[model samples]
Target: MPDFTATTPHIIPLVYQPDSAHWFALVRHLPHAVWLDSGRPQSTYGRFDIIAAAPQCLVETRGANTSIRYDDGRTDESALDPFYLLKKYLPADQLPEHSNSNLPFIGGALGYFAYDLGRRLETMPNLARNDIALPDMSVGIYPWAIIQDHQHKTACLVINTELGQRLGDAYNFLEIEQLCASAAKNPAFHEAINCIKSVQKSFKISEFESNLKVEEYQQALAKIHDYIRAGDCYQVNFAQRFSAEFSGDPLIAYLALRQALPSPFSGFMQLEAGSVLSLSPERFIQVRDKRVETKPIKGTIKRGATPEEDAANAEWLQNSLKNRAENVMIVDLLRNDLSKHCAQVRVPTLCELQTFANVHHLVSTVTGELTPNATALDLLRDAFPGGSITGAPKIRAMEIIEELEPTRRSLYCGSLGYISADGQMDTSIAIRTLVCDGDKIHCWGGGGIVADSETEQEYRESIAKVKVLMDTLEKEFGS
Candidate 1:
């Protein structure tokens, strides 16, 4: 294989199609920084279209020409280890690291390993080497590192075709603001929402049994546990069940869904056959001010119908010893991972439960200063798969995962985001995500399993977490 380094400026693009507009792109320069001023009107100081951050690292990549396919049957282990490859291409010493005192940049990069397929890789011809035609609408590549401001809207689209070039050159923050303003003034956004609602009316809920019987799954899980006992790995995330299928262009479904539910990490990526429509809200990793911080989400409890009930559930989750222990295990795991590349590592913030619109999570902040020789890539490699998903003693966990899980986890648990030419990087854990290929859609959800893990609760949590996506799909297409 060839070792390629990014020497020139790279433009990462993000494209999206609302109900009213044709596909549009958000473009920005890489390796830029964004400073968020919570109290200010415009809270941004970076050049990038979109930025997704993570609490810790969990991204992997198979190098060019090696055939260790994670999803497909092809298994070649020599594929560039994403962590190792990143270290060689983008080192920590060359990039800026964030500190606990300062804010950190966050983002993620997740998707099917299309690079493994020679034919698929051709479509996304590397811009670093050649000048290729871009879509009519394109956005800048997401900068990996930046300061996130919660006050102002910080979003961008990335373009990668002629259409993208035209849209990018004409589009800017001001233009986007105008578009959003106009969208808000008129009923376009609302109309789009209603359209999606109409489509969702047709969805029906159904369950299917796995062809591989429960015994098969049990055997897999047992092997995983055996590996765990053997100490070959620490925590391995295992998942089962391959479900969800449809007939139609996923892009259409993607457009409709975005209108109904707009997200900070909304993206439309062109791939083989069809494209991937992601509306993820999780950040995988963020680097800013020379300090690196990661927030791994471990626990989940559903929201209640009423405000009082919701608050009660959130409070209950916060005080749940079981959830807290799970969150803490990953927190400690992340601290040790970061310490590999930095000194003075600290877990100043322990398990603090945070709630989002959909579910509740036990979140903790881990911080560390990069050592003289460490690079962002080094930190990522040292802790490739975030512990929340894998469990403690990461390696053993992985072996367990391999044995328990029946299907290969392509982009479900991997990382997704961007890396800048300047060495700033950010990524997100690929959870609450959907991966589609033509008519087939694969979505995965699992929780950390300790010695005290309950098979039924764990099963329920996985199903509950996936309910949102399942419901969304049901609403889109009728049973």
Candidate 2:
């Protein structure tokens, strides 16, 4: 890694959503910069939801025509290079050799970058044309070394651990007082609200059912059970499908859905012209300082409307023997997966039931120390498509999925996040997600299938998971 000491003074704070037209322009032109898009959908009401892109590399005390020509051809190449562009600006040697499961990044310390930059921006904030809150979505950037997959119409962004650290640190360092006060006065804030109003009426739900025979699905589940019984696999995450046809721009629909229901792992990714709106709540995997962690969510139960009823439902979910068993089975599966990539593997946490506003879930945390030569990419490849999504004996589960599922998953279970120059990476299990290919839009939802799993219950769970997407659209655009 080259020494970044000389360039430290040049680093400054940048706060802009990446999806906005202007912010996109800034990223296209800025050099040695970090671009982030939190995939939060645009809202027609309340605090203007934002899609911002900030040019961190161009912040300086004196203004120099900080603009560069955007080569449309370059966008294809630029989006693919996960590490090539960021490597130029980051100190490679300063990065750690091992990964960290606890901290954000495992390679170098980009957390400091976010920390220093966020603090500086606080002192000298950049003026924006719009008043939009950064989308409260998962944060990561694509590396600039990889080539855009024009065939798949997807781009890869690399995020270094240093950048991850920087973001985490900066998030903690934010001056909430100043931000809140500034938000009150921004005129664009009101404009953002109006935009939400204009589009709110356009939201609608489109529904569809699978062509696969119900008996076939049942047989598939039975096969999965047979595999478990034979010790071929301990647990397998089996899924079924339901899809819908959409008429408007898929990207636009995704944005509206996000505003209606923002999830912790929400993502908005532009894969060529097609985009994905994901509101997943599961963390697939995270690497920091040579340690790895995965939180697998297995069991789920829908929430009730009343507070008391919701609490009762959560309690019931927590006490349910079947839910607990499903959760543990996945936990064991994840432990074995981690064991392949790391040493000292252990399930420090197990079968912890967590309740979200919409549903209650059974979650467990597994951890391990990374082996030497383990890169963030290597971790993802070894554990591509998390265990919770894929049942135990992942390979067989996937094969069964291909046969049972009617359409390509596309970004349904695929990840969207940045891998930094320092090798820090975080990705979500693409659940509660919508994939838009032009006017056609499809969203997916399913749950783990175990030996004792009931067909009707599983069917309901799948629909329950996607209710937010359904309701958001109907409420916003009308049925």
Question: Least lDDT summed over 10 consecutive residues: which range in candidate 2?
Answer: 109-118
All candidates' TM-scores?
A: 0.64, 0.65
Quantify all predictions' global Cα lDDT against the true fold: 0.48, 0.50
Clashes of 1: 92
lDDT of 1 by residue, 1-479 (tens): 23322232223222222222221211111111111111111212122233221111222333343322211122333345444533332332445433212122222222322211221222222222111111111112222322222333233322212221221232233443344345445645555534434554343333323324556655655665566567665445556544665665454555555544444444444443434555544555565544677777776788788999998989998888877877887888888888888777777767676554467767777777767756665666556666667777765565455445655555556554554433455655656655565556666767776655556666667666666666666665645
Q: What tens digits encode model 2's per-residue C-alpha lDDT throughout 1-479? A: 24331111112122333233223322322222221233333321111112222222211111211121122211212222222334434433433664332223212211101111111112322331111111112122321221122223232222232442332223211332233234436666435534544654444556555534668666766776777677666556655455555554343465566555555556554433344666666777776666778888888989888989888988888888888887887787778878887888888877777665478888788888777756555666556667787676666666556555544454566564444445565666777876555545666777777777777777678778887786666555444
**Model 2 misplaced stretches (Cα beyond 4 Å):** 1-10, 14-186, 201-205, 208-223, 226-232, 249-252
In every candidate, how many clashes are there?
92, 60
Model 2 residue 468 lDDT?
Answer: 77
